[model samples]
Target: MKSVMIKNKYWDIAADIYYPPGFSEDKKYAAIISAHPIGSCKEQTSGEVYGAALAEAGFVVIAFDASYQGASGGEPRYIEDPTQRVEDFRVVTDYLMTLPYVDENRIGVLGICGGGGYAINASMTERRIKAVGTITGANYGRLMREGFSGFDPISAMEAMAAQRTAEVRGEQLRVDDLLPSSPEEARSLGLVETDLMGATEYYRSDRGRKPNGVNRSMFSHQAAAVGWDAFHLAEVLLTQPLLVVVGDKVGAFGAYRDGCEIIGRAASKNKKLVELQGWSHYDLYDKPEPVGMALEKLIPFYKENL
Candidate 1:
């Protein structure tokens, strides 16, 4: 694996390229770009795990830090703008196409968590991505507008508007923690116990924590996040082969249901949904067993389509 910096109009994206064993620059190979979850970096979540595993399966894989997050260059750091995130995938695809050892026509993308939504959105217009796969897919827009347990969208929008107003007045941007600071706080907020446990263990504890993986996002990001839609025009534009994976345990959560909805709406005639029983949303991020199960299906899907 090697580190690379992809130059974009708005930021320089930091990425890690995982090369297949005995990879030769003289020969072209299928390439896949793996996008990480929101408020996370390449070193965490599926970016590193899935990228390395896919590379070992004989495909070149690149996992990158989204602009304004992690090691990527951007101002007003940690802002989760869905549009820019979607464009980052396109920029990475452009970089992949320029590589001597990458097959431009066989480029694919695999995104985890919120990145999954961005991947699906990007694939709609960026036809260069011949195949797309998502693990525990999440639509941030929906999540931001309607809380996990169906909070009032209007109140959320009002809060976002107030934050934007404050920003306009030169006030410091407000930040929101991705996970509760403690299990007690999570419980007090009435958050799902399993969701809180997984998130806290992954982001707060040493299990999946990284120096660059901060657990906060700009409050004003709600402006862009709430307006964007991962499945927007998917019925007409998402023509590439699509694969959506989700843990059976997460089906009760909105993200899993959103993934299913996306698949049903996508125009891709080759779309498929694979549910891994006994796994939760966070389990597929880095757990060896679930990650292995995901790669088994992902490898063949990309090989056949791309």
Candidate 2:
């Protein structure tokens, strides 16, 4: 793996590029861009799990930290802007197109969780993406509007507006944690929802924790997410080949339903949906069995399509 930076607007996006064994600039290869989940960085499942596996399977892979988050550059960090997140895919695709060893026309994408949602929305117009695969994908806009699990968007928006007003009035920026302090706390609170339970174990613990993945939310900038939708116009514009994978566990985050929605909504005639029974939304993040099962479908899909 080689760490590199790609310029996006005025900031630099921190990314890790993985090359297949015996890679050579003289030969062109299919490439896949891997996008991490919301509040998560490239170092988690995106780069460390799926990215590595895809690279080993003979395609070049690049996993990047979205701008304004992780190791990427941006101001008022952790904003979770849906538009900016979708744009990140295009910026990374631009970088991929410049590499002599990468066949731009054969480029594909793999998005996990919130990243999946962005990938779908991005592919609608970024025709450079020939294929799309999402694992436990959630539409961040939907997630926010529903208050990350039906917690009341109206009340949440009211608080967000208040925070923005306070900041404009010379108050300090307020950052909020995305997860509970620990997995134990989540369990004790009866966060039995697969998304919350597994997220706490993965992002908040050594299983996938990293210094750049503090999982914080920018209070003042959150409302930008409410008005966005990952599947917006997908039924008409999502023409690229699509593949979606999800675990059977239906958490409050509703990744399972979102996965089904994309499959139904996308215009791709070659689309496919795979369900891993007995697994939960977060299980697809780092669990060996589900991950392997997912790649079993993904490796062939990219190879055949790209």
The candidate that achieves the highest lDDT relative to the unseen native structure: 2
The CA lDDT of each predicted structure is: 0.86, 0.91
Give lDDT tens digits, candidate 2, residues 1-306: 999999999999999998898899999999999999988999889999999999999999999998899999999888888888989999999999999999989999999999999999999999999999999999988888885625687777888899999999999999989899899999898875667878899888888889887889898788888878899999899998899999987887888899999999998999999999999988899889999999999999999999
RMSD per model, one decimal: 1.9, 1.2
In order of appearance, the predictions have TM-scores of 0.94, 0.97
- Provide the global lDDT of candidate 2 against the true structure: 0.91
| lDDT of the structure predicted as candidate 1 | 0.86
- Write model 1 residue lDDT over 187-223, tens digit each, in one string: 6788656655777767776778887788788877667
Off by over 4 Å in 2: 149-151
Model 1: ten consecutive residues of lowest lDDT: 148-157
